[model samples]
Target chain A: MKMVLAILISAILVDNFVLSKFLGICPFLGVSKKLDSAVGMSVAVTFVMLMASAATWPIYYYILVPDYTYLNTIVFILVIAALVQLVETVLKRFIPSLHKSLGVYLPLITTNCAVLGLAILNIDETYTFFQSVVNALGAGVGFLLAMVLFSGVRMRMESATETPKAYQGIPITLVAASIVAMGFMGFAGVADGIFG
Target chain B: MEKKGRLSLLFNGVIKENPVLVLLLGTCPTLAVSTMAVNGLGMGAAATFVLICSNVVIAMLKNVIPDKVRIPCYIVIIAGFVTMVQLIVKAYAPEVDQALGLFLPLIVVNCIILGRAEMFASKNSVLNSALDGLGMGLGFTLALLIMGSVREILGSGTWFGIPITAGRIDPMSIFLLAPGGFFVYGTIIAALNKLTKGRAIKRKSMGCDGCPSAAACGGAGTGQCPPDKEGQS
Candidate 1:
C-alpha cells in the first residue's frame, strides 16, 4: 500500500513525464500554448494514455512477449491507432461537447508521443498488468497537472509583454516551460516523506 | 511525373527545410540528447541510419501501400528500421545504446522520419528520396550537436563529458537540466529565426499581410505546406 502511494506521487510529481523523464515532450511543447486548449489537450491525452497503457499491458505480456516480442512495436502502434480512432468516434457520438471542443485534437492523439511513451515506460519498468494500469493512470494525471499548469502560465505570458520582437512566440513559450520545469522540481522530495 | 532531381532534394533539406529548427519536429530528442556532445553525435548517427533506411524502403514501397493504411505502413517500416538500429547499436556500441534508453525505440515515432516518409519519400523517386533523407538527417544531427555542445560547455563546465573548467570556473548548472534544455532550445531556435527569417520578419514589420506560410521557407519543396502530418500531428 505504501509503495502504491509512492508510485503515484513519484510518477506524478518527482519524476514527472515532461520535466524529468522527458517523455511526451512533443505534446508538452506542441499543445501547451493556450490555457483552455492546453487543458483540453491534457484531458484528452490523459484519457488516451490511461487507455493505452490498459490495452498495451495485456498486449505486451500475454500476446507479444509470450510469442513474438519482435512484433511489439508494430502491434502496439496498431492497437494505439485503432484505440484512438475508436475514441474519436465515441467522442463524436457520446460526448458531443467534448467532440466539439477536441474535434481535431482527437486524431492527433494517435501520433502523440506521450501516449506511446507511456506504453513503452510501462513495459520498461516491467510492471505487472494491474500495476501498469495504475502507473498509466498516474502518468496521465501527471501529464494533466503539468499541461494545465504550463498552459496557465503560457496564457498569462501571452498577454504579458505585448509580444516582444525577440521573445515573440515559441521562444517565450519555451521560457515559460523552463520556469515550470524548475518549479516542478520542487516536488522531488514529496514522494520520499509520504512513501517512507 | 517530373523526374525528381537530386539537388532539389538536397537543397530542400539543408537550408530551406531543416527538420529541427525550422519545422519544429522531434524536439524531444533535440532537447534531451543535446545535453552531451557524444550523446548528440551518437543520436544523430542513429537517427540518420534509421531515416535513411526507412526513407529508402518507403520510397520503394510507396506505390504498393494503400492510402488508408499509409500511416500504419509507415509505422511498420520505421519500426523495422528502429529495431534494426537497436540491434546494431547493442551489438556494436552497447554503452551508447543503453544511454539512449527508450529514445532509441522512440525514434520509430519521430516526426521528422515519419514526416519525411509520408510527405516526400512516398511521393518522390527512390534516389532523390534517399538524398532528401540523408540531407535532412545530417542537418538534424548537426543541430543536435551544436545544441548539445552549447549546453555541455555551459552546464557541466566540460565538452563531450571531458572536464574543462575543473578548479577554474563555476558551471552554469542550469544548462544541464530540463529548464536548461528548454532555454537552450529556445535560444537556438530564436537565433535561427533571426538569421533565416530576416526577410519574413522584415516583411511582417512592413506589414506584408498574413503570416507568409512560414513553412515553405522551412520545408522540403514537395509542392505542399508542411504535410499537415508533420510535427506532433
Candidate 2:
C-alpha cells in the first residue's frame, strides 16, 4: 500500500511525464492552447495510457521476458500501435460523444512518447502488473495536471501584449513549463519520505 | 517542385530543418539525455543511425507500401532499426545504454524518424532520403552537443565528465535538472530566432504546424497545411 502511494505521488508530482520526464511534449505544447482541448487531450491520453499499460504488462511478463528480451522495443511498439487502433475503433463505435471530443488526438496518442514511456518505464523499474497500472494512472493524471496548468498559462500568454516577437510562441511556453517543473521539484522528497 | 542539390539537401537538416532545434521533432530525448555531454552525443548518434537506416528503407519501399497503412508500416520499419541500435548500444556501450535507459527504446516513437519518412523519404529517392537522414541526424547531434555542453558546464562545472571548475566557482546546479533543460532549450531557440530575424524557422503560429506528425494527424484543427502556403493554395 505504501509502495503504491509512493509510486502514485512520485509519478504524478515529482517525476511528471511532461514536465520532468519530457515525454509527450508534442501534445503538451500543441494541444494545450485551449482549456477545453487540453482537458479533452488529457482524458484521451489518460485512457490510452491506462489501456496501454494494462496490455503491455502481460505481454512483457508472459511472452517477451522469458526468451525474447531483445524483441522488447519492436514488440511493445506494435502492441501500442495496435492497441491505439483498437481503442479508436471502440471509442468511435460505442462512445461517439467522447470520440468527438478526442478527435485526432486519439490517434496521436499512439505516437505520444508518454504512453510508450510508461510501458518501457514499467519494465525498467521492474514493476509488477498491478504496480504498472498504478504508475500508468499516475502518469496519465500527471500529464493531465501539466496540460491543464499549461493551458491556463497559454490562455494568459495569448492575451498578453508585451511579449516580444522571438519569445511569442514555443520559446515562451518552454520557459513557463520550466518554472512549473521547478515547482514540481519540491515534491521530489515527498515520495522518499513516505516510502523510504 | 524544383529538385534540390546534393549539398543543400545535406546542409538542410543541419540547420534549416534541424530535427531538434528547427523542426522540434524529438524533444523527449533532447531534454532527457542532455544532462551530460557524452550522453547527449551518444543518444544523438543512436537516433541518427536509426533515422538514416529507416529513411533509406522507407524511401525504397515507399511505392510498395499502401497509403492507408503507411503510418503503421513506417512505424514497424522504424521499430526494427531502433531495436538493432538498442541491442548494439547495450552490448558495446553499456555505459551509454545505462545513461539513456528507457529513452533508447522510446526512440521508436520519436517523430523525427517517422516525420522524415512521411514527408521526405516517402516522396524522394533512396539516396536523397539517406542524405536527408544524415543531415537531420547530424543536426540533431549538433543541437544536443550545444545543449549538453551548456548544461554540463553550468550544472556540474564539468566538460565531458571532466571537472573544469570544481573548486574555481560554484555551479548553478539547477541547470542540470528538468527546468534547466527547458530554460536552456528555450533560450537557445529564442536566441536562434533573434539571430535569424525570425526567419530561421517560422514561429508566427503555435499549432500542429511545427509538429512532424501534423501531416497525418488531421482533425487537431490546426490542419496539416503550413499557414504561409495556405494562402497561395
Judging by TM-score against the true structure, name the best candidate: 2
Tell me, per candidate, how large a share of the native contacts it keeps: 0.46, 0.64
Q: Give one digit per residue, the lDDT tens place, for model 1 in B1-233.
A: 24456676676676667777666677788887788888888999999998888889999998898876677778778888888888889899999987788788788767788778877888888887888899999888888888889999888889977898888888898888889998988777667667765332221110111212222212211222122322233
Native-to-model Cα distance after best TM-score fit, residue B220 in candidate 2, in Å: 13
Q: Model 2, B1-233: lDDT tens per residue?
A: 23568889999999888878876668878988999899889999999999999999999998999887788889889999999998899899999999999899988988888888888999999999999999999999999999999999999999998999999889999998999999999898889899988887653444654556766554223234322221000
lDDT of each: 0.75, 0.84
Predicted complexes: DockQ each = 0.44, 0.53
**Which candidate has the top score in DockQ?**
2
Off by over 4 Å in 2: B1-4, B218-233
lDDT for each residue of candidate 2 in A1-196, tens digit (9 for 90 to 100): 9999999999999899998888987778777777777888889889889988999999989998789988878888888878877877787889988767664566777788888889989988999999999999999999999999988888888788887888767788889889988988888888898789
